[model samples]
Target: MGVFVASTRPKVVVTRNLGPETMPLLLERDDVEVVVWPEDTYCDRKWLLENVRGATGLLVMLSDRVDAELLEAAGPSLKVLSTMSVGYEHVPLPELAKRNIRLGYTPDVLTDAVADIAIMLALMASRNAEEVTAVVRNGEWPKRPWSPFMFCGPQLSASTVHPQRTAGFIGFGRIAQATLKRLVPFGLTTCLYAGNPATPADPAADAAHARAFGLPRVARVGLAELAAESDVVFVLAPGGPATRHVVDAAFLRRMKSTAVLVNAARGTLVDTDALVRALRERWIWGAGLDVLEGEPVIHADHPLVKEPRCTLLPHIGSASIETRQGMAKMAAENLLGGVLGHAMPAEFTGTK
Candidate 1:
């Protein structure tokens, strides 16, 4: 028998340290040359461009943009582009498609992690967690005594018999399903969802999801119905032109005065200005946001920053150490899958 050798070991460039557990998976391949970025920090564009030259695969984070210029810099050898994130908005898809680059991303892996954060944000925002923390930290707790409705917000587990106890979802998907599972224990009985209609293949997935969650009914309602009926509306949709500002002024206006809003999906899905206005004007009860539109560059004076009713997180939806490590390992697999000409274990089929 003749010893088989790979024609040429494919060159792989990982933009960051994918954690200790994942490095072994990439290193086990005998027919691959893996080059990790030197620093434990984000790779600069110039460094990425220089290092990516002549590479066969590129594993990146959402911070790095896989645009046409980067693809050109990488040359025709670039076969795969995998990101360690569920969202692909940062990647230049058309450019990648033009260059015949395969795309891979971690989607389902982080669903449960993100859903847990969403529910936490909803609870924190509704209960004024930040304000309460500030009060306790500032030594005001000893000065002031607890009183009825002093820092009270809407009760999430309040009796389902009340018509005001509905939960709404802007985009219902796997994460939404997981979130509903957590909410059912809180007495959520009615759920309203708005997104692309259910398909024939998964004809009853939506209905089945409702039954599994123990919700009395789950219907695909229009944006208006979702806004008007929900006591707590969660924005769990993707970001893009079509779904941008899905929670604008008009939608916010329709929400019940006591309703709470939670967004753990994308920041661009809601207009921050409109949300600030809604909170200031009492259009909706409050808002909990894990992701912000402009991100780390959010203005210090942004209205949401000053609004007491809004709870803002620094985009830590997938910050759990275990979940992050899993995502990194999955992303490495995706890149290796493309390099080895095998189907990715978790491949993105592209936007429908």
Candidate 2:
């Protein structure tokens, strides 16, 4: 009898369709068997758990959970999991480390996109743009009579009257740097960022930023100073237990009453109840958020939603078409690299 050989194709499961821009990379490969979730929305957990069995690699969204149960179901054959989003909180790092699975995430590709949102949120929050727009949407724009100083709020730019502005960042990362660069045109005088205190201070790097951005001062400060002095505070920090609720009532209470808060980062970084209280008590002027603690399902009656001074989005920080396509392409490349035993293009080794 003739000898029979089995196919050595690696099995890859995709949580959501990557569309034509990225799917062709995997579909054209004869060495890979690709199984996609086949839907527009989030992939159902039941379907994911069932199909993820024997997967050699998985390209997942932030909605999918890559925990011990998923890892066990994927068996020893699962060597890689690449997330389309920059955040990886959905995937447990310990579990991946235990199984020697490489983690890949899209990072720099979305930096500009997120920074744009951060600035937009700052402007919107300061101007109360959300509530103003709602008047038009609710068919009350014609009925509501305008008065002098009716919609007046803090201005983001520095004029002759307000010659200097200080911008603050919760985390000094690529996105935060991009945001600082964008603020240069607004006549920002000083830049302050808060990072892990355990990490050594880099005066040289801060000096470089000041020189590069033409700012008078670029310094690192503690959160208390950042909250107190900033005209606008951008929350661009990473999410995890270490950073959870970093912006509690104490932090919010310290902020300038006219200063605006913009959070384009993880929702858990800010304490929701504290924020609501701050807005209600007028401790801060307003807030613009692209993410919320219990997100993707915030009801209309949700306190933040009902708060006229608050402008919120459904975590669309990286929703730009160019950014999404780039992320999809990178995620596909990472999956292929891990499956083929090659070095991933953007493998996350975690902070040292």
Candidate 3:
């Protein structure tokens, strides 16, 4: 009888522990060797580089920079990169395409979770919850002077007396549309969106969306018009050079003083310094943000943190238990599929 030989199993390096629910899907696979970063926080940069050497597949978070240097560290053995995020800003797509590597990301699963948080942030910003909570937490509520209008801000919906509410979106993608759906019950009368000008206009589609959402009108408009007309403006645009600082001093200055600004999208879409000045000068009613520029490094003295009108969250738009688990499972599936030479569920087609 001829002796049988076992083929070498492909190796995969996951950047972080994927939690109890999803880690086993990778660990129990006998056809692959799985290596995971033991730390809960972003895997140490040096450690990631060392472990990625000779890795056939890589699983990363949005915090990981999958650029030329890291790609070089992974060597030619790397065939696939999977990220547990909807956004791919941290991944260098052109470099990945140059190397003929497939990319995968979590997308649709996060839409609802993020949309919910967008609405929550809008409410928080408009109600001045950040300032109110600070007062209560600092034990100043008892000594503070109470007035009828104290802690009051603009209402999200139009009252019976003033029944016209307009919601503006910087990007009318899935999450933005989901948020608009949620806002329909709040009596939103009109919807305005500013799409990427590079893409062709689809007025018919916009009209369809408006009809489906029960809004009297839904149309694409210029950024300046959107900033000026919205009762509450939601920034859901992608992050990149073209979109960076799209919402700056000039844009903020155009917004209604009673309008609220909510950013549940990329931090770079809004200029941090400009936003600080906007809040300080009361250019707009208040601002709520789930992501911020140079986040995870925000100091106690950060101007936005100090600003009473800015309600900040530590990027928890997709923090729901169900949503995170789905993201992790899909990311693992994508990594395994790519390593096994199978089709990825959510392959990044931008490079293709």
Using TM-score as the measure, the top candidate is: 2
The global C-alpha lDDT for each of the candidates, from Candidate 1 onward, is 0.86, 0.93, 0.93
Clash count for each candidate, listed in order shown: 0, 0, 0
Tens-place lDDT digits, model 3, residues 157-275 = 77887699999999999999999999998888999999989888898998898779878899999999999999999999989999999999999999999999999998999999999
Cα misplacement distance, residue 299 of candidate 1 (Å): 4.6
Q: Lowest summed-lDDT stretch of 10 residues in model 1? A: 197-206
Inter-residue clash pairs, candidate 2: none
TM-scores for all candidates: the values are 0.93, 0.96, 0.95
- For each of the candidates, the C-alpha root-mean-square deviation to the true structure, in angstroms, is 3.8, 1.9, 2.5
Candidate 2 ranges with C-alpha deviation above 4 Å: 1-6
Better of 1 and 3 by lDDT: 3
**Ranked by lDDT, top first:** 3, 2, 1
- Model 2, 1-352: lDDT tens per residue? 9989865788999999898988999999999999999999989989989988899999999988778998899999999999998889899999999999999998899999999999999999999998888888899888978898877898899989888899999999899999999998988999999988778999999999899999899999999999999999999999989999999999999999999999999999999999999999999999999999988879998999989999998998899999999999999999999999999889999773
Better of 1 and 3 by TM-score: 3
After TM-score superposition, the amount by which residue 95's alpha carbon in candidate 1 deviates from its true location, in angstroms, is 1.8
